[model samples]
Target: MRGFRPGLVPTLVVAVLVPLMVCLGFWQLSRGEYKRVLMQQYAERRVAPPMDSTELAQTTDPAFRVVELQGHFDVEHSILLDNRQHDGQVGVELLQPFLDRATGAWLLVNRGWLPWPDRRTPPVFSTPEQPVSVQAWVYVAPGATFQLHADPVAAPWPRLVTAIEPDKLWAELGRSGFSYELRQQGGPGAYRTDWPVVSMGPEKHLGYAVQWFAMAAALFGLFLYLGWHNAGRPHGKHHESNQHV
Candidate 1:
């Protein structure tokens, strides 16, 4: 008859790791659901008529809402967001301040991704001298980034940065209400703006959850295979054989 016995070391490792793996699977499942809701919101709002900056001001959650603004691009004070990747090629994202002509408010606008000719030389871009109208989606800064040191926003015009720190930029520009960023629609001073609707879609998260669960299952199986022989006690014929020996 089979029994349920396992070695001390294997038992200890399994006890510690199995639960951790299962917990990771559950976490990924939750993350997947969150991503699903966010993607749904994006899809629904994609077709809605664009709201102007004044209308966008009243929005409680302004992320992903299509919006428009009449502004002049601050070409001299633009920033190049470094370490951006597109289509397996390394590049940077252009971020420039847009001075709203109607409200006289300045907000950051992400022009789009641009490929680097090389690391040393900065990419060249031309901005329109006259005031222009822009249509874009409202973007709330989503998360934080890891940085060894705080990026100096006051270093120079056309700043190169690892991440956007709106507060620092606002302070540098001496502008107040540096709240939301605009993800520009294809227009003048815009590049390839095909940003991902969802950074990690539900399918990707679900796949990760499956992988975590699979690892847990494999660990349990290993514990069983390694410990199986140690399970059953000696019985009947085996007992007799032991006595004879």
Candidate 2:
């Protein structure tokens, strides 16, 4: 304390910045933990035996639960979710209404991604006319629903949109259906079904946490060094006297 004196401005800056950096570090850690738990749940539910529509309707938490679907796709009212990228190629995901014959329940199914290189023409995709058996998993978005741009209210059949709202789609179509979207697994009615559970993994969050914490430590260290260095400097009067002598 004798030879270390931090200026008021520096102390104030450190007071604000250090705590902010530390809080950010902890926030990143929490995010990493959350992603880890989410991925674990996804992995567990994905491998379990596929459930029927009746069984699926009863389940409360069905994030990645696989379901066996005996349904035929409605090709007329197709939804193209825009701004989807695969292997550095721009594309859109095709979603169609499927009527499950067994349970008489309709559900929105994401068939998969298709390359839409030219905007002048619609994305090319096909639908199965006959009732087919397919396996798919319930896809629940992790956080709040995001949409880059709102879908037009009166968009025609084969609607092109930035987001998917199955409930709204069902309401518009005047069909009683499952609210959640079912992502089709590889089969007759699937295209590029490879989906990443999380965009940024836990490791990325952990790395960001380390960076924030390291920056905080470096700032505090610099604060200490500056305090000591400033305190050790000679006063103006002492320096003037010494120069004159």
For model 2, residues 191-225, the per-residue Cα lDDT tens digits are: 99898998889999999999999999999999999
Task: Compose the digit string of candidate 1's lDDT tens values, residues 20-97.
Answer: 999999999998998788878888897888887887667888888988789798888888988888878999889898
Error of 1 at 118 (Å): 1.2
RMSD for all candidates, in order, please: 3.0, 1.7
lDDT of 2: 0.91
Top-TM-score candidate index: 2
Candidate 2 stretches with Cα past 4 Å from truth are none
Q: Specify the poorest-scoring 10-residue window by lDDT in model 2.
A: 142-151
The true-versus-predicted C-alpha distance at residue 157 of model 2, in Å, is 2.6
TM-scores for every predicted model: 0.89, 0.93
- Model 1: colliding residue pairs: none
